[model samples]
Target chain A: MNVLYFAWVRERIGVPSESVETQAATVNDLVEELRAREDRYAAAFADTSALRVAVDQELTDFDAPLAGVKEVAFFPPMTGG
Target chain B: MRIIVQEAPFDFGQQAQAFASGRQNMGAIVTFTGVVRDDASGALTAMEIEHYPGMTEAALTAIANDACARWSLGDVLILHRYGRLTPGEMIMMVATAARHRRDAFEAAEFLMDYLKSRAPFWKREVTAEGASWVAAKDEDEAALDRW
Candidate 1:
């Protein structure tokens, strides 16, 4: 699956986008998997309280299922005027 | 109800005039423009906006539709420009028309909030130091919660 980052989220993660092979079943599970990888992922996922997720272009919660999801985007809320 | 996503510049006066001309009973017109900032507090210098082709359009269309459904809006126009944009460049514009000022103002504000938090565009900025991606802000998402 492809995971994308935006704004400061990309900076914290060290990459704008990445394709990872995972065995996660839900968005929260994926976050946990990434958190296990290293410090960068841990920092990015450190405060899931401040982050928002979208799966396959639809806004969803972290606990949402990602069984067949192709893309997952995580970012701070949004600040567009 | 027109939605445009392009990299070109637009004329707000012309757009507002056209919208007003078409509506005989509209009493208010509200518009909002988002400009590209010269700096993103060191995160970005020059910025490029990337979006999911079909998904971007669909998401924006749905936002505009949602605005129309919630308000007594007469017409709505949303234009977001992508690609590489310089500082002070216009990033997007949203205009709304309604029979009353309150409805027009609230709808316009609501539409902008929704687009900011829900749109699929990703922005990467370049500076003299290096290039980095911009992250969404918590405040931006919180703004929509009021509506």
Candidate 2:
């Protein structure tokens, strides 16, 4: 799976995107896997409530199933207009 | 319906004029433009906008389509820009055409409300002091409850 980050989350993670090999079945499980990788990942995933997730480029909750998902993005709430 | 997401600046006046042209059947046309604004200190140098590559267009199109279904709209146009932009520069614009003024105006407002929070775009304000991401406002989210 390809994990992507944006804005401050990108800055904190230190990279925009990365490919990960995981056995995670849900977005929260993936977050847990990433969080165990390093301090930066832990910090970024520390507060899931402060973050938003998208599975396969569609906005969804962290509990969303990741079984056929190709891309997952994590970012702060959008401030567009 | 037309949706445009680009890195380059757009000509709002020309686009608005073109969107309203040749619509003899439509009685009303409403257009709204969003501009980058400086902070209260007036030290803003630029606003950097970031968006998801493939999802931005899809999200905007879905919002426009929903507006069309809810309102009796004849046409809709949405143009949003990304990347670095200076203060006072146009950030985005939405134009709606309908047979009645109320439909056009309300549809435009609905588009703006959704665009403000639902879009995948993120904005950061740059100043001499530093750069900071613009946090989503609670009111912007609450504005969606009306529709």
Candidate 3:
């Protein structure tokens, strides 16, 4: 699966995109895996309220199922125009 | 519908006309432009905006779709610039077209509110003292909750 980040989320994570091999069954579970990677990941996911998640281009809850999902993206509340 | 993320400046009057032209069904067109400001009261030297490539577009696309679902809109345009920007320069634009004035107005408002609170872009201001990342505004998030 491909994981993506945006804005300061990308900066904190230090990479824009990465292919992840994970056994997590849900988006929340996947976040747990990422959080365990390093302090930066932990900081990014430190407060779920500051972030929003999308699955395969659709805005979804963090608890959304990841079954057969091809892409998952994490970003801050949009500051764009 | 068009969504542009660029550092180049844009012409609002031209873009609005293009969005409404040839669409007889569109009775109302509401547009909003966000410009760079000297937030620090002349203390800031420069402002630089940054965005994530793939994720930024995807996020904006989702936001545009959501606005479409909530309003009877004919068309919408979103333009946000990245890189260095100065006061008085246009930073972003959101335009909505609809059959009625209310829809166009509401959709345009919804798009701006969502963009301010949801889009994935950050600004770092270089001040006379030092450079610092601008924090997201709580009032912007509160504005979204009103709708």
> What proportion of the real contacts between chains A and B does each prediction keep?
0.39, 0.86, 0.67
Please give the range of 10 consecutive residues that has the lowest summed lDDT in model 2 chain A: A50-59
DockQ for all models, in order?
0.33, 0.90, 0.50
Question: Model 3, range B7-85, lDDT digits (tens) per residue?
Answer: 7888878987887789888889888898878865777677788776665687788789998999999988998999988
Q: Candidate 1, residues A1-81: lDDT per residue as tens digits? A: 999886677878999789989889999999999999999999889989888788997778999998888989887765444
Candidate 1 chain B lDDT trough over 10 residues, lowest sum: B38-47
Among all windows of 10 consecutive residues in model 2 chain B, the one with the lowest summed lDDT is B36-45
Per-residue CA lDDT of model 2 for B1-147, tens digit only, reads 999999999998899999999989999999999999876757999999999989899999999999999999999999999999999999999999999999999999999999999999999999988999999999999999999
Interface RMSD of each: 3.0, 0.6, 2.6
lDDT per residue (tens digit) for residues A1-81 in model 2 = 999999999999999999999889999999999999999999998999999998888899989999888999999999989
How well does candidate 2 score on lDDT at residue B28? 99
Question: Which residue pairs clash within candidate 1?
Answer: A6-B134, A7-B133, A7-B134, A7-B135, A8-B134, A8-B135, B46-B126
Q: Distance from true position, residue B103, model 3, in Å?
A: 2.7
Q: Arrange candidates by DockQ, highest first: which order?
A: 2, 3, 1
Q: What overall lDDT goes with each candidate model? A: 0.82, 0.95, 0.84
Per-residue error (Å), model 2, residue A14: 0.8
TM-score of each: 0.76, 0.98, 0.81
Where does candidate 3 stray beyond 4 Å?
B23-25, B58-62, B65-70
